[model samples]
Target: MYKAKIFVNYKPSVLDPKATVIQQTLTRLGQTNVDSVMVGKYFELVLQGNEAAVNEQVAKLCSEMLANVNMETYRYTLEEVEA
Candidate 1:
């Protein structure tokens, strides 16, 4: 088995309105130390496949469907796991 930890985030060039709102809210609540906030997606996936195969498939999915190449960037860490 394989375990995949994936993170999807908006490109730096893309404006994150949700994160901007969160940052503003935090500032209003007196958490002024926070410089900024960016929202993203996180996922833990368990797959029944070899490391090489799982890695390839995960990369394919990330580029093809999991993230928007133009505006979002995605990265994943794959590791062996017990079945």
Candidate 2:
């Protein structure tokens, strides 16, 4: 078995309105140390198949469906799991 951990985050140039709102709220509450906030997504997947095959499929999913390749970036790492 293999376990895959995926992380998806917004690109630097892509501005997140929600994060901006959060920062503004914090500043109004007398907290101004935060420079900015970025939102991201995390996913954990368990696969019961060959490592190479699963890695290929997971890469495709990240590039095509899981992440927005235009304004977002993603990476995944896989590790062997003993049963």
Candidate 3:
């Protein structure tokens, strides 16, 4: 069995509104060092097959559907699991 952990995040240039909310909350709590916060997505996929094939298929799926190429970037790590 093969498992994939995928992480998707916004690009550096993107402005995340969640950052403002977090900063405001921190300031209310007397913490000023807080700078920014960005939201991201994490996905785990499992496939029953060879490692190489699963990796390729998952990568393709991420590129084609899971991640938005224009403003988001994604990366994945694969591991073998014994059942």
Candidate 4:
């Protein structure tokens, strides 16, 4: 078995309104040390297959479905697990 930990996030050039709002809220709440906030998505997938095949599938899924190639980037880590 393989475990995939996927992270999807916007490109730095793209403005993240949600993250900006959160930062503002934090400032209002007296989090003066706050510099910035970034919003992203994290997904955990358990897949059954060989490492090579699983890696290919995970990459495909990240590009085709999990992230928008034009505006976002994705990365994943694979770990072996006992069935």
Candidate 5:
């Protein structure tokens, strides 16, 4: 078995409105230490496959559907899990 941890986030060049709102809200709440904020997607999945195959599938899914390659970037960690 394999475990895949996926993270999808906007590219640095892209503006994140939600994150900006969060930062602004924090500042209003008297949290001026905040410099920036970025929000993204995270998922944990377990697959019944070899490490290589699971990694390939996760990569494909992230690039093709989970994230927009033009505006976002994704990274995953695949690890063998005893099942």
Candidate 6:
């Protein structure tokens, strides 16, 4: 078995309105030390396959479904796991 930890986030050049709002809210709540806030998605998938196959599937899913290639970026880590 393989475990995939995927992370998806907006590109730096893309403006994240939600993150901006959270940052503003934090400032209002006196969390002045927070310079910025970024919103992202994390997914943990347990897949049954060899490392090479799992890696290819993970990359395809990230690009085709989990993230928008034009605006978001994605990365993942894979590890062997006991079923």
* Arranged by TM-score, best first: 6, 4, 1, 5, 2, 3
Better model by TM-score: candidate 4 vs candidate 6? 6
Task: Give the clashing pairs for model 4.
Answer: none
User: 50, model 1: CA deviation in Å?
Assistant: 1.6
Give per-residue CA lDDT, model 4, range 1-83, as digits (tens).
99999999899999999999999999999998998898999999999999999999999999999999999999999999999
**Per-model CA lDDT versus the true structure:** 0.93, 0.91, 0.87, 0.96, 0.91, 0.96
Which residue ranges in model 5 land beyond 4 Å of their true spot?
Answer: none
Per-residue lDDT of candidate 2, residues 1-83 (tens digit): 88999999989899988888999999999998988888789998888889889999899989999899999999999999986
Cα RMSD of all models vs. native, in order, equals 0.8, 1.5, 1.6, 0.7, 1.0, 0.6
As a TM-score, model 5 comes out at 0.93
Model 4 error, position 82 (Å): 1.0
lDDT of 1 at 40: 99
lDDT of each residue in 1-83, candidate 1, tens digit only: 99899999999999999999999999999999999798999988899877888999999989998899999999999988877
- lDDT tens readout by residue for model 5, 1-83: 98889999999999999999999999999999998898999989889877778888998988898989999999999888899
Worst 10 residues of 3 by lDDT: 14-23
lDDT of candidate model 5 versus the reference: 0.91
Candidate number of the best TM-score: 6
Count clashing residue pairs in model 1.
Answer: 0
The residue pairs that clash in candidate 1, if any, are: none
lDDT of 4 at 27: 95
Worst 10 residues of 6 by lDDT: 35-44
Compare candidates 2 and 4 on lDDT and give the better one.
4
